[model samples]
Target: MDDLARLVATEDVRRVMARYVYSADHHRWDDLAALFLPDAPFIASTVDGSVQARMTGRDDIAGQLKARNHPDSVLVHHLFSSEIDFESEDSATGVWAMEDIVTRPAGEPAGMHGYGHYRVRFTRLDGRWLIAELRITRLRLDWTY
Candidate 1:
């Protein structure tokens, strides 16, 4: 791998990661679907024994995100970091630890706080990189009853 190739691959990985966080936080379901391949697989789990379940396909991803962003949940902040791993020039995998804090209307209980980790897989197709799989494992969760 040459220096230029490495730089380009790194940049592509970074851009895809940024898009994943931004689209999820902003509730841009359509954009979020675009972050992955047409048949990407996703599974999100929480420590509270609640599982968001595994979903496949772009349409399914969009549907899941739409259902996740509720009216009471005013905001979603997904902080990703500590990325580690790249298998090849066209394929790689990494980890991203995230913190999501949600806010709600006054009087009502505020939204939950979640800490989780994502195992991300990337694949390049036609010069563009996209997520192939995203498996989320929750470490901690705090929310009102």
Candidate 2:
């Protein structure tokens, strides 16, 4: 890919991520699921490789997250400093710096405040980029529940 093409692809990838953040924060589970490939995997872990949770496929990812996320919960994610490189015209790898906060509903334990890097593989499918695999490795993770 030329520089111009790569630039456009990077922006497209970022747009997908922004959509993910919006859907998640808004608790739009199905919309969040649609951002991934049907068989995509979502993995979360600590920096030392102790896996916290892993969900495969878009439906499983959406369902599990929806079940775990209480209706009154508050979640926010901030992503920036993305580094995206195209491996081919239809495939790319990226890393995004992220900080997030999750607050549980009243009467339950509060949730987590975290800083992490999202390492992802993206593939262009049906004219848009979708996450093929996503891994979150926390640099600092603090949780109460």
Candidate 3:
């Protein structure tokens, strides 16, 4: 790809990643459906085997995530130091260093603080960038009760 084209694709992929974290943090589960391809898969696991899951299809991805998260919990995700590589005009791959804190309101159960990396694949379809596959692996995950 040309320099300008690569630049634009990079920015577009960044936007998609931003939207993903924003949607997840805000519990806007439905909005996340639009950020990924219909048949894409979402996978997450921890280094110590605390968690492991896989879901496919946009609707299933959103539905399963909504089910897993507590309604009263607050989630904040910080993504830093992303390395994105363009494989073609329509495809790219990225790894983002990430941290997240999940807490609940008063009287709620415990929460967790996590450090992770998101390895993702991106595809451009219909003039829009979307997450084609995402695999999240946590290097450190701490739970409080």
The CA lDDT at 125 in model 3 is 97
Note the Cα lDDT for every prediction shown. 0.80, 0.91, 0.90
lDDT of predicted model 1 = 0.80
**Candidate 3 overall lDDT versus native:** 0.90
Could you give candidate 1's per-residue lDDT for residues 1-145 as a string of tens digits?
6778877887788788888888877778889888899999988888965775878989999997677667556666575675746678888787878887776666655467888888889999999989999888889878843
Q: What is the TM-score of each predicted model, taking all chains together?
A: 0.84, 0.94, 0.93
Clashing pairs counted in every model: 0, 0, 0
TM-score of 2: 0.94
lDDT of 3 at 83: 95
Ranking by TM-score: 2, 3, 1
Q: Write the per-residue lDDT of candidate 3 for residues 37-120, one digit (tens) a residue.
A: 999999989887555789898999989989878888889999999999999999999999999898877676678898989999
Across 1-145, the per-residue lDDT of candidate 2 in tens digits comes to: 8888888898999999999999989999889988999999999997677998899998899998998899899999999899998889999999999988999977776699989999999999978999999999999988856
Q: Which candidate number would show the highest TM-score if scored against the true structure?
A: 2
Q: Model 1 compared with the native: what TM-score?
A: 0.84
Q: Is candidate 1 or candidate 3 better by TM-score?
A: 3
Candidate 3, 72: how far from true, in Å? 1.4
